[model samples]
Target: MAEKASIKCPSCGTEVEKPKKTWPLIGRPARDGSRIKLMIGQFECPRCGRKFKVAVKKERIPPEGR
Candidate 1:
């Protein structure tokens, strides 16, 4: 496993599995100087089958537990 942590589905609050391939990325840099991390872990809801994004940086709990 690349790394893992707890991350709930924004739509269903279902604890989703964080895969190693799900590398964290900046959602998109703002015209301003600041940027926000986005929900790199995109998934198709097994129940709804709707594409949705989820933020893992905070809940992903790095291996080092940063």
Candidate 2:
């Protein structure tokens, strides 16, 4: 199962949901030999209304019964 991605705000320490819209920033291989893409974007905290950076790690899922 894929894990839900999330990151905390550095200023407010609020658990913010990962941004659905993002641009690729970096690419690297994971320990499991899967290709992982690092995405970056900006988001505003709903509670504090503070803008902050949002980073998300994306990996490809293998076909079922692989």
Candidate 3:
């Protein structure tokens, strides 16, 4: 299940939007060696204009019509 990642601005304390980019989780790799198993997200606060990064857990979605 893909849960919503709560991104809050540290300076203004406002909830930020979802991250635009995601990278593979540190030290953890997918078994396939190509798929992304665990990952983190990078977000920028729109309210304070501050760039921040947070660890986010996301599940991979399978393609439709299996």
What CA RMSD would you report for each candidate? Answer: 8.2, 5.6, 6.2
For 5-62, candidate 1 gives per-residue lDDT tens digits of: 6666567776666533456675444455346655466666555555666555632222
Each model's TM-score, in the order given? 0.39, 0.54, 0.59
* Ranking 2 against 3 by TM-score, winner: 3
How well is each residue in 1-66 modelled by candidate 2, as lDDT tens digits? 987766777778787775545787644555665655556777767668777766666556433345
Deviation (Å) of 26 in candidate 1: 4.1
Residue 59 alpha-carbon offset, candidate 1, angstroms: 9.8
Which residue pairs in candidate 2 have backbone atoms (N, alpha carbon, C) closer than 3 angstroms, thus clashing?
A: none
After the best TM-score superposition of candidate 2, give how far the Cα of residue 62 lies from its true spot, in angstroms: 17
Q: Candidate 1 versus the native: TM-score?
A: 0.39
Q: Name the lDDT of candidate 3.
A: 0.69
Question: Which residue pairs does candidate 3 place in steric collision?
Answer: none
In model 2, which range of ten residues has the least summed lDDT? 57-66
Instruction: State how far residue 34 of model 3 sits from its true place (Å).
Output: 18
Query: Clashing residue pairs, candidate 1?
Result: none
